[model samples]
Target: MDYVIEAPLVCVCDLDGTLLRSDATLSGFARDGLNRLINAGVHVTVASGRSLQAMRALLNGVELGLPVIGLNGALISELDTGRHLLIRALESTPARAAVAILAAHGASPLITSWDGTQDRVHHVKTMNAASDWWVAEKREYGDPRLRLSEDLEGVAGQEDVVLITGFVPDQAAERLLEQLRAELAGAAIIHAGQHIYCTGWTEFQIQHPQADKGHAVPHLLELTGLRGSTVLACGDHLNDLGMFAAADESIAPANAHASVLAAATATAASNDEDGVIHWLLRRARLIGAS
Candidate 1:
């Protein structure tokens, strides 16, 4: 779709392997392209798996006025206000059940709880070497938010958790993924990145069924009061499929996973070469914003 009419368009972008380079930094090419869109009056924001805190950290230099989607749709936070427009948390009963099942299968989850203003992540202190890698890697960033405990089952007893995520070996991730999907009746079980961020690990995440990127699209649209605007989405993984379903059009980077590539309306350059920038330049022009 050209989206060339005189009306504004809404562009929701995924961060990790879509807008950010492999090293997880937004490139100047994209920054300039986004600025052009802002000047042209398009509504642009990010929909990412990153938490709100992480998104703000990653978007340090960018002056984005629009509210960004975070935690894969678990939140819609406004940077200027330091407030959340939406909060979707998992129910206690099923979430605890999920943890028990995964734990039984030798998976230790990093439980994510949103205490309205911040994310309180709790993980079991006693764990195997595989789970330790994910924990240690985050610690290397000096992110003080993670709260580890030897008594994680007690720490995670509450039901208002936003998400629960974990990492495992590539071989083990497959079996856990299947088990989580079949057993966790009321939740969303997902797998991503066989080797996330260059690390040789596979990731697993669980959330409320309502906490989906596709749902975030409409929530953002409603909150912005930008009804009827064309939805332009871009992503690079299976997790982005929900975002694609909510779009009038979608783009996937050249390096995107095969499933994401198939779902996109078009394919652009790889992330390392400013693929999102290339797509946005065209979008800005089509809407007379260029």
Candidate 2:
């Protein structure tokens, strides 16, 4: 079969249900395809709502040389070197106000921060339960940095806070988001995803107005000496929208949310079918190779 080898195509991908199948595992075809892409000098980066620490654990066995866009673009870190490229954090004043609003609505927020080195600090109220991501964090980090807040007012003013997140039921989350948009006019409100639906709220992240994965993609490309037109991005959620819209070519798996699928230039096989590998093979013209 004829082949087309494109060198150094920059591919930014999402986790969860994109690269990793819905079962939270990487299929062999996907694994081999990713390895092939890396061997061909493609720059593959993980861009997701996951924290840097969590992403590191999930990608531990994969050998990809690229930085990660984490926390919906609030944090960026080099995958191989563990170097922090940039971190856009919420300013204390707005962060505190956000927390107060959530608290009043009977929801608890998860506050995230980074120490000077490899540690992450997460503060949550006593009543809050663990999230799948949070559980993964604890298992990997061995006592992932955590603190209890009688009230988040104490840590609200701390410097270097990157994100303030909370689990809300769908309806309440929707209502709180409406209020937040009005009250915290300059802040960015994102619904990362839902673990379960409670009263209509879902998992959400509150970030600095400027912190968004979409905004981070261009910045990361600049750092890597690449251009927007040279990049291809794949994602499955609203948080992925920013980068999705900004990429030269955008792709989504068949199972992607309607909004996400609508933004992509093409749709690939579902993650269960090793969609990433399937798409990459076609893009590189490697399919049907003997």
Candidate 3:
């Protein structure tokens, strides 16, 4: 599909393997280039598995012209005011069932929920090395929502449970994914596969049935009065497939997973090469060194 520059346009981007480098950091070149796109009247926003606060930390200096899709599209929050535009929270029954299934399969989840005003993340002490590393990384990032929980199952019964995520070995992940699908059925939305940054480890995320980038994109278009706009999306993992399907055009980084590359309408340089912003700049017809 051809994108007309003159028409209203929206660019929804993924963070991990699509925008941020392997070290989970954003480069100056990307930051500047993204700001330029926003300045030049391209409606830019992010769709990420990261929480809103974490996303903000990574995008500290950049301006997002629209609400961001967070928690793998379970949450959508306004950029400047921090207001929630939409939240597809998982119900308590399904949440508890999912937690129990994960535990039975030898995985403990980091549970995330919204309490109207802010996020509350409940985590067990540690189930494995990967879980320990995940907690440490969040601490290093200054994640304020981290709450030590002795009863993760109880936390899952909360009213607004948004995300249940964890990491496991690739082999275990496959089994766990199969079980969750067979058991949970239509109760939750599940995304599981190899981690984009942490090799040998697979990440599993469970959320509300309507929660995924594809569903969030249409809501965002309506909220921003851009439903008629040409929508372009960028992503780099299995979780990104939903957004890719929803977008008019989808761009995947060269380093993206094989499935992601195959699904994309076009490809760009790898994340280390600052691909996303470069692609946007060229598509927007903006002049800048890539």
Candidate 4:
């Protein structure tokens, strides 16, 4: 497969169930496809909700020199320099208030902070399969600053917090979001799918006060020194909608969320089918050469 393209084109990909299969591993086909693109000089960057520490492990062997967009755009860091290009922390007042509201609703809120580098997330005792994502990352990154509090009042005041997440049972997630909207009037709330709820501060106050992937994409383009038209973004969740909306062209894995699939310009194979590599090869014209 010789889908090799020239350098300077920017390709931003979402990690977790997008680039990596459900087992949290990248397929050989995806790796080779991405390598072909990089060898041809295209820039590839991972845009993910995972902290830098977790992302580093997943992207460990891949060699693409680009800053990653983490925490759904709350943090952007240069891979080589370790310098953060952007850090959008939710205002403490609103974060704290939002935490209180979730606690009252009996939601298990997790507070996350950037430890100058990488995220330090705190969660309660209950566990689920999705919890594997966080647990494995924590083991790899070392134990996080764990806090098991019923009240989130003090959790929000921590200095330099970037994201706050909570888990709602599949049945109640939607209703919780509606109630949250009414309670946290000015805050950013997003349905991250898989029964996960994300609440944070908005990136901008002037235009749309919502914190979305759309707002994050423009900032990423500027940081990568590419125009939106020159960028190709791939994602699989609703949180990826903004990024898809902002990309010059975008692809969603076949198993992607319905909304995300609808928003993307193209659909690749499922992640298990090595969709990242499949699409890259097709787009770059690297489909079947040595």
Worst 10 residues of 4 by lDDT: 199-208
Candidate 4 residue spans exceeding 4 A from truth? 1-7, 115-119, 124-137, 140-152, 195-211, 287-290
Better candidate by lDDT, 1 or 3: 3
Tens digits of per-residue lDDT, candidate 1, 1-290, equal 33433777888999989999998888876786676676667788999988776777777766687899988898888976658889888777667766776677666777878655566878887775657766776676665668866555655565367777776767777787777878776566455567556366677778878888999899898998987899899999988999999999999999999999999999999999888778777767644322
Largest lDDT belongs to which candidate? 3
Candidate 2 wrong stretches, greater than 4 Å: 1-4, 115-119, 130-137, 140-143, 149-151, 196-201, 287-290
lDDT values for all models: 0.78, 0.73, 0.86, 0.68
Q: Candidate 1: where is the Cα deviation over 4 Å? A: 1-5, 126-133, 136-144, 286-290
Candidate 4 local lDDT, 128-218, one digit each (tens): 4344345555766565555455445665676556777655555666677777677666665545355322232111111113345566767
Which numbered prediction scores highest in TM-score against the true structure? 3
Tens digits of per-residue lDDT for model 3 on 1-290? 22335666799999998899988999999998888888878999999998887888899999887999998889889866668899999888889988888878767688888876778888887576666777777899898988999888887875489999878889788788888899889999998877666678888899999899999999999888889788999999888999999999999999999999999999999999988778888888776535
| Model 3 poorest 10 in a row by lDDT | 1-10
TM-score for each candidate, following the candidate numbering: 0.89, 0.88, 0.94, 0.83
lDDT of 2 by residue, 166-245 (tens): 77666566687788788888665555456532333477678887688789998888887777437888887777888888
Model 4, TM vs. native: 0.83
Residue 199, candidate 4: C-alpha displacement in angstroms: 21
Candidate 3 local lDDT, residue 104: 80
Scored by lDDT, model 2 comes in at 0.73
